[model samples]
Target: MGASLNEIKSKIASTAKTSQITGAMQMVSAAKLQKSENHAKKYQTYASKVKQVTLDLVSHDKGPSKNPMMLKREVKKTGYLVITSDRGLVGGYNANILKSVMSELMKKKNDDAFSVMALGGMGADFFKARDIKVSYELRGLSDQPNFEEVRHIVSEAVKLYQSEEFDELFVCYNHHVNSLTSEVRMEKMLPISFDDVTSTPSLDTFELEPDRDQILDQLLPQYAESLIYGSIVDAKTAEHAAGMTAMQTATDNANSVIHDLTIQFNRARQAAITQEITEIVAGAAAL
Candidate 1:
């Protein structure tokens, strides 16, 4: 049977409500994304500069070589740092990171030889469901993230790597490029490539406070901290942008469905009235 007028009206009203909610969400996401992108840009400059300086300091073995964060160890067990969104309805935001991690797992010769840690709810659940060894997970990460929040998690991972629990560590996240484009990214964090340091030469002489070892002791941790913070900012921006686009698409689809349903409802109602009027006219003519 075709839908009645009341049914059609109700459907339209429901769709309208949904559109309103989605519209509001899109605006909110856009605003958040804007702020996130700005943060990313500003921090990216600093992060790149930090990485360059790090590479410069470690060159010629001038910096602390024995530090776990700076040590080069044998690749026996792999450690992964996975970042994803805590909530859903963000299109492929969570799935993208999950797939990258899955790809790494699938390609590995010894899945049992590796351990993982998640930075969000989706990643934590995905690894748990698969029975993968997850050392740590931080859920419900906020829009503006701080390194202080995840410092312990990083420390544990670094310590584990030092202790030979994992020889190397990797990270997977979404890299925010623009409002419409976010790319899935997989990055390795551990065994800070001292070799990569030589490739990048420092333009300025980094003056050490008291001495180079003392300065390095403080700088290395800050460098690693900045790396994590920058990644979080990039991932969050991508998440918001993806959600806004996905919601807008859903709203459009709902509008189209309601339009088709209303047309069907109107056509059915018109036919029913026409049939009743024709029968009455025939009866009158017969009389």
Candidate 2:
């Protein structure tokens, strides 16, 4: 009885330690999630303004000054810039995004039909393990990523599209709907179409400095880079939220286990005490 009680006590201690670790992780992830959310929100304003100005220029132009990014061509090869977290313990976060990419890849008739640009270590390793070609890869992004960190990869993707390496490019990631819910999303990034731009009624007009075409030549690429950067910010937010929720669940489960073990320990101790009392009473009667 003593041995059993001691075992239950040990289990309770171990479970409580686990609960503490997970609880700490949960708090850290929550803090990161808040920071990521704020960064993403602030970035959206700049991204929207850039898109608006780029589209406005496109709309007002009457000439045949069609930017190459805006023109659509035959899509012989496609590119996927997949975003995933470098670390694990984010419940189903990496799995769902990878699954979504696989589902899209399964649609291709040929193995060489598409290539991938992985933005995180998880995605980079995943694609490489399958012998899939990963043209560009980056890892170890901060919890709240900055645009400069991702600019090089974004520029490379846009350049590849322009070079006709892939006629179209898509970015895949998990979209944060709430703290507890996220959904996988694939967004087209290349062959920029005016139709894809969100339309807003604006009475504002801008006086051109150099020329509309020249400004577009610079603005269009920046706009595409901004799109990629914005997606990365959003994906990071989702990753943090997923991590926070997963840690919270783990802590809860550990605490539940601890509770059960504590109850068992109490019952065993009580049983031992009762047995000792009965033994003493029997001795007294015999005397």
* Clash pairs, model 1 backbone: none
lDDT of all predictions, in order shown? 0.78, 0.89
TM-score of each: 0.87, 0.94
| Top-TM-score candidate index | 2
Error of 1 at 60 (Å): 6.8
Model 1, span 130-245: residue lDDT tens: 88877889998877666677787777776677678888877778998888889988777666655534364553465544555555567777776676667778888999999888
User: Cα RMSD (Å) between model 2 and the true structure?
Assistant: 1.9
Task: List model 2 lDDT by residue over 47-85, tens digit each.
Answer: 878888777777764445578988888889899999999
Q: At residue 1, what lDDT does model 1 achieve? A: 24
